[model samples]
Target: MAKISLRPLDDRVVVQPQEAEEMTAGGIVLPDAAREKPLRGTIVAVGPGKMLDSGNRGELTVAVGDTVIYGRYGGSDIEVDGKEMKILRESDILAKVL
Candidate 1:
């Protein structure tokens, strides 16, 4: 298995998307293309906070090692240290995994 580390800056977050399950309903084993991209991810790193219009930094809601669910069209994909990772602005994350 491959692993990665990231340090985001200025209201950004480093996330690794969680892979979807291999099986489907009615006992069907689905292939990679038959599944939808998971919108969830693990929070690898978080930025300081959002910069306010007055230059004040807001509080951050997400933390490192937290599992999260993000938006479909959000985040920028990149390969870091030979592994895939996503660099997302904090606002792009939709919710945290329970």
Candidate 2:
């Protein structure tokens, strides 16, 4: 894959979604339409921390290269350099994969 030039702003992050499952546990192949949207992804880019009330930037816990799980319907889908990506607010991320 080509390197993406996108840079998110203000606590937003760019994620490269994991590929959807192609087969079930029973070894049944699933068609594309039957595949579920991926909830897991790797952070490709990160924004500067969000602005805080004290005029200081609040630090974000996640960073580039972090693998995370997000809400099922959170974030906006986008295409960058012909690759599908998601732009999510820091708050939209559910958990960081250990």
Candidate 3:
């Protein structure tokens, strides 16, 4: 994949969402409108850590190339270089796939 040009500020990150499943477990093909939004993605770009009151930047646990699960309704969806991506705050990310 081509590299994304966006740089998120603070505790935000850029994620390339995984495509929604095209078929059901029962072998039924799903139409676009019937497919659920994907809740998992791979991190592409990460922002600098959020500033802290102690005159130091707080460290972020996640990093680029991490596969993470996020909330279904979290983050802003955008298109970068004709590719769909999500920009989410660090808080929006739920868990990292080990």
Query: TM-score for each prediction?
Result: 0.83, 0.96, 0.96
Q: What's model 3's lDDT at 57?
A: 84
At residue 92, give the lDDT of candidate 2: 99
Alpha carbon lDDT at 4, candidate 2: 81
Tell me the tens digit of each residue's lDDT in model 1 across 1-98. 23356668889988877878788778889888888877898887788888889989988888988898888889899888866789999889888778
> lDDT for each of the candidates?
0.83, 0.94, 0.95
What order do candidates take by lDDT, descending? 3, 2, 1
Clash numbers, per candidate:
0, 0, 0
lDDT (Cα, tens digit) per residue for candidate 2, span 1-98: 34589989889999999999999999999999999999999999989989999998888899888999999999999999888999999999999999
- What does candidate 3 score in Cα RMSD to the true structure? 0.8
lDDT of 3 by residue, 1-98 (tens): 56788999999999999999999999999999999999999999999989989978888899999999999999999999999999999999999999
Candidate 3 wrongly placed segments (more than 4 Å)? none
- Give the candidate number with the greatest TM-score: 3
In angstroms, the error of model 2 at 89 is 0.5
